[model samples]
Target chain A: MASSNTEPVIIVEGLTARYGEVTILQDVSFEVYRGERFMILGGSGCGKSTLLKHMIGLIKPHAGRVVIDGVDITRADEETLHRVRSRIGVLFQADALFGSMSLAENVSLPLAEYTDLPPELIREIVRMKLGLVNLAGYDNHMPSELSGGMRKRAGLARAMALDPTFLFYDEPWAGLDPVTAAELDILIRSLNEGIGTTMVFVTQELASIFSLGQRVIMLHKDVKGIIARGTPQELRETSSDPRVNHFFNRQAD
Target chain B: MPEMNHRGYRLHVEGAPGAQAAVRLEGRLALEDLKALMADLQAVPVKMKPREIAVDVAGVEYLDSAGAMALIEMENLSRSLGIPFELLGVSEKDHGLLCLIDREALQRPPLRPESERPAIVVRLGEVARRQYRDVLEIMTFVGELVAALAYCLVHPRSIRWEEVKFYMKRAGADGLPIVALISLLLGLIMAFMSSLQLKQFGANLYVANLVTIAMVRELGPIMTAILVAGRSGSAFAAEIGTMVVNDEVNALVTMGFDPIRFLAVPKVLAAMVVVPILTVYADFFAILGGLIVGITGLDLTAFTYIQQTKSSIRVFDFATSLVKAVVFAMLISGIGCQRGFQVRGGAEGVGMSTTSAVVSAIFLIIVADSAFAIMLHYVRH
Candidate 1:
């Protein structure tokens, strides 16, 4: 209940997500506290990504509301949504960096568009952000020129450009070697600690869940809603739900 | 004393000229206040001309990274001017934000040079080398296409007739309306212009002669081919280019199918079969257009116009036009598929290949037409 002591930055109340006739998440509700690393875990074809999309306001839900920092993004106007979006960043599954832009240009894009800060200050911030992600000197490299791991790191740097209050990651560990994935895990942890940004991640990586997630919510396709909610350690050892217990045990094996 | 206030965020510098300066920052020092922050900070050294400056952030209610960078930038400016600068009363949280970035790293120049261009001679050499490689690539692709076509001929059942029918509908039947429209307009315009001249010589019936000959021998096949080049050629390139980008072409190869025979052969075969038929349709529509002008504008009977057109064009002329249509069809579809197979990058690459396909197809069609004119003349002689 230490998390309950803190104010909730994101409130998802009775959210229902549907694609055509199929319901992916129904009447799902959860709260993510300030400065918490929350992981959304589930089996394949579950509503993990659908829920993340609803949370980020990329896709509207069939029913319910997602309020981020006092603004209900699902119901917000364009101006309000734009304002709320400026305070957040998302890292996509494929590290969706613009192929046409250099790393420096990509990192500086948000600053240039949103702020009236001078170019030199923006450039300096770009360098510092890139430095934080261990890509200090790769400012001019194109997205196509970098390896998959480097591109992911570059994507993280761009995501951190505005020092967003909330950061969302969609399967950041996918398509990486174990070493690179572990390195990425450390980077995520450091960034969360350094900036104190609330993070929402959609992933099925058990190692990342155990290592990084402070609180976890598992979704099941059959349930069409949150199946389990607890600390990773608690979910591993003390979960009453057989499906949740089986998920933790099967992955560990 | 100089001060800047933007939305209650304020920067105040108190000092006499060429003397010690104390700068105080107050209110929310965040992103929205940064422009005023930098403007005020930049003005401090200019107006006060301080030999030493101290920035006090204790009055600041909140500070973010952009605000932190403003302070860092101020320190750099003072240092460059040989003026002593100090940051005072920064909270530990703000200090951590400030410490996250190393000033030295920001000062380091980027590894890449900005827009490096070679000497003119070297650029010319590169362009020439690229052209040579392009020609060689086209030759290799043509060789592969010939071999694939030969294989298909030996095994007629190997051709994917379903795709051929689909492409025929796409490239031929779908294109018929536009082809008919443009040919009709072409015939109407030619007959109108030529009737004015021939009427002066009391040869008004010769308008049919002129329109029928031009439509069948030259304008019919060439215009149809050019329109198809613009329509189906770009479509073929973009379709195959996107397939290459998505690695579907590679998948076909990996699954033990020749990509050219699997993808291009159907399109080429469909175009080769249908484009000539489209040319014949174009010729007929053009003649109908000429007949309209003959009966309406020139006061000539339909029977007279039809007989004059029949007398003007020989079977030899129709044969040449069909030959030209077949050759132009090959060039258009062939160039499109070749450009598609040459795609290397992503969406932009596909776009470039599509545009190149249309331009190269049209250019080759005109060149082949000119060569045909000369060869046919020598053969007739």
Candidate 2:
């Protein structure tokens, strides 16, 4: 691992997703540099989630490829998809944990799903994850028992359970308290420093995006293709996309 | 899927010399005239064996049993008159009508016999071959479910015995009291109903025999099973179905654990283990219910009732009932788990799959129980 700034780790070329007669994304192209906490910032219904979905291989693009770490995940088979997906941890919008299981169980799910580790080792990994989220003692609590912040933390723990190379957080600050949000941002920062993990945060939550993202790719829905991609300060001062400022509109510390 | 209309008809009249015909029909035929011709045949003034009586029905759109019965009567009349009768509109729908009157009407003439038959099975086979994976998937799920249980025996720790225990308590023990109560009341009701009728014939003592025979041979095991199936079986479906919809199954799959081995084996094992036990309890309560009836309604002593039950109910009969319970247990739980794991999409899909599981399981249980009863019947004889 270089552990240094380098070429983009993710590149989307001429990407589009279409229904019968409607286009969701149109010939969109972008690149995410290595070690950059690059964000795709857009308002709701602006294809932000759709773009993120394409990146994680949940939904395939209509006409382009998602090249992640040099492997094209656009048309991957199950094993390939699993491998690619495991490398990219996704925090789904609603925290898609298995409801029947407890917090520790949820965090351990990916590890349990993909590893051949003994139960004892799996328990240790789960303990380690919960501990990272400051949820060290809520291991046996069901998802329903956790508050919004706690649930998000548990979900984060699960997402980070596999020690993914890249983390994708979808609106992680949407429903959390400011204190919790700030704590989460610090945790994310600590995680980045500690593991040197690359991150792609998809959010219109301005505070979280600005505080967490090192660079940003703003989506502009003009009659043409995507309008801009740049660093936060460069985007804040000089970006021409009207949608760009709108994403940063509700920015509150 | 089916449509109906009431509309017009027309009649035409034609026949041999001196034959007079009048139509009782009142409307214009949708197209050509056939009623007038039937009237022509009915007039029959000549009282002669005409070579043939002919009617064209090609324009007829609607037909009634009256119209069809008239045709039947006219055919008999033709046999009497020694004239061959002919109907022109021999389309498929018309042929169906003719078949209703006389099945031979649908039979093909020698030249067209093979041509008219459907290519349904061969075409269906081709379609099945093309959609073979669906068949393979179903087979695989069923195979894996069975293998999962087989795996459980050798590797019990791999199966989550705790979850199975949880479901068994929910599905079996908690539900057992109600099931037992209902079976008991059912035995009392059957005995009471039969006692009213049999008392008229002064055969009150045989009521014990009736209750014993019916409960052990048919009602106790079947009713108790059906109650449990509807109660606990549907619960199994809904619970597991919810897990499936919530991506728990996918989570399991990604974890390198076979969901069937992880999920289904436990539920299947629990139900298979518990249902027969529940059936035995139901049997005990039902006998108790009949014994209560014997003392209060029939004036027969409890000892007499018990004696008659013991003397009449054989070990083989009890075995048959218990064996049926065990089999029904397997069927209900297996189908319930199968449906649960097969859930697709949201709340509506889970609900539908649960309903289907109950219906299919109940029907299969009844059918298998009937077959088992018949085999036992033959063996006993």
Candidate 3:
């Protein structure tokens, strides 16, 4: 639906990553369309997180370019990269909140840095962001004082502080229980619909893939590239690749 | 289209004076000029004190969360001023953002204010209790270390020689240059200063006696101990403290490894073995330094100086210096491991432990040296 008229929001062209003599990912290419939910699923050590990092320009590829919002972040100048980065947000797996700052301070940091808004407006925006994540009235809690699920939600609030057009999540459900993770999944879905923001999720959670993924790419360790690319339903119902089938059906092998 | 600034904001008021007024806002209502926007909204109710104010935002191009919140704040201000107010031309996207903010949540008070600082007497008492607990913890750690060392003594094959070797290279070999440099300079300064007085008495040869006696007994061992404390002692604390912070130490314990024996013993053994050897090297470099001063500054032959140094130092002096070196090594390594084990919290805790390791090691080294000096004086007499 987002083809032709509007350009793709992200373009990862001919990406290759190597660690010493070992090739982790080779000649991987993909495009994320505007306002679509894209999922990257792979087995452990299959380079899911590595690919996500490359897509976000956190780790430079041995050979490739990642263009976000038409700016090639891989080769962009600092000012251009910063401008490109301002339109996107990333939620790391470890919930990298500043241990020294309170939850409100963590959420307000981007607003204070990037905007010329008054302190009162920034404060209200922080409240709205936190409230969006169901973390209302917890502005004074330190990151150390919060539970794991709470910290993850707080991290999400901080990521959404600038209302970025693109959101990238790295294993958002890795450490949560089923109920909490399901709640988080629902929250992500609501935010996606409400904000109409493009999202790229790197996860192995089949439930999340089925529930939220509009498009999916499966990375394979042996092949060192994407093995299957399609919608989650198509991959689950029609894919002939044994690896893709094994992953979707939760097979042991 | 109305005129707008570079930030894309404009405010227009219509209706004659003292008549019902309509306020029109146009262009991008975004975070960039929110401060000025807020000032404009505040001026709306004051300037006209209008009986009714209608805010129209249909011409607004963009509305961020801050922009939405600013409009809400304006509505609240108008309500408090008892002026009838209404918002017009709310776009679908803007209305969604406005609905997302929970107004009651914003009005809720913070959970609690920051706690006030305690009284001086209470803070002093807390510090005293903390120091007391620190002493008790040190004693317990010393006991555990002794037990682990005794176990290793009984089963020498059980000692981790690999770790011992690794630490030896770090604490001993890597520390040689600084130890050599500082002791050499110390010996040169001592000899030169003592030579001035000795030259007055025309006893330049005795400068060798003074330098040899001082270097072998006090300066050589103490200077080497201080350097080792600064180099390896802080390193030991920081390394182990970071492990504690990362839960690596806890993992080792959960896997049935005695953290003291597994982590501390090798570093302690390495320091004890290398520090005494380093002190001997320190003594040699210091004497060489005294020989340089004697030849260049004191007009004494190397052979004469060497002969005086040899006669001045007995086997008793070497034994005493080695004893001091070994004891200082134990203190440095022991306090370092103890402080590291006591670490809590995060990276700040590791930093605090590292600094405490160096300062405490130097202090204890000087204290022990004083005790040795007094005890050795009576024994020599």
TM-scores for all predictions: 0.90, 0.43, 0.91
Candidate 3: segments with Cα more than 4 A from true spot: A1-6, A116-124, B1-3, B13-23, B46-48, B51-53, B83-85, B192-201
Ranking by DockQ: 3, 1, 2
Off by over 4 Å in 1: A1-5, A251-253, B1-4, B12-24, B42-61, B77-92
Task: Give me the iRMSD of candidate 2, please.
Answer: 37.4
- TM-score of the second chain for every model: 0.94, 0.63, 0.91
Cα lDDT tens digits for candidate 3, B188-256: 998899998989999999988888898899988899999999999999999999999889999999999
Candidate 2 stretches with Cα past 4 Å from truth are A1-204, A207-253, B1-138
Candidate 1, residues A100-185: lDDT per residue as tens digits? 78999999999898887788778878987887777878888888888889899999888878878899999999999999999999
Q: Compute DockQ for each candidate against the true complex.
A: 0.43, 0.01, 0.46
Weakest ten-residue segment in model 3 chain B by summed lDDT: B1-10
Docking outcome class, model 3: acceptable
**Tens-digit lDDT string for candidate 1 (B1-381):** 656544657777788778889998888777776677777787787656889999999998777666777788889988888899999998876776677666776677777754579999999999999999999999999899989999999999999999999999999999999999999998899999998899999999999989998899889999999999999999999999999988999999999999999999999999999999999999999999999999999999999999999999999999999999999999999999999999986778898999999999999999999999899889778
Candidate achieving higher DockQ, 1 or 3 = 3
Q: Write the per-residue lDDT of candidate 2 for residues B1-381, one digit (tens) a residue.
A: 111224355454544443423223334331112343334446542353456666566655544322443455566676566666666654564455344333222121222121243599988887888558645755777788777778788887887879889878877898788988897898799889999999999999888889888888888778877887898778878988999878888899999988777777777788877887888788788888888888999999989899988998999888878888888888888888777877775676788878978887888888998899789878999
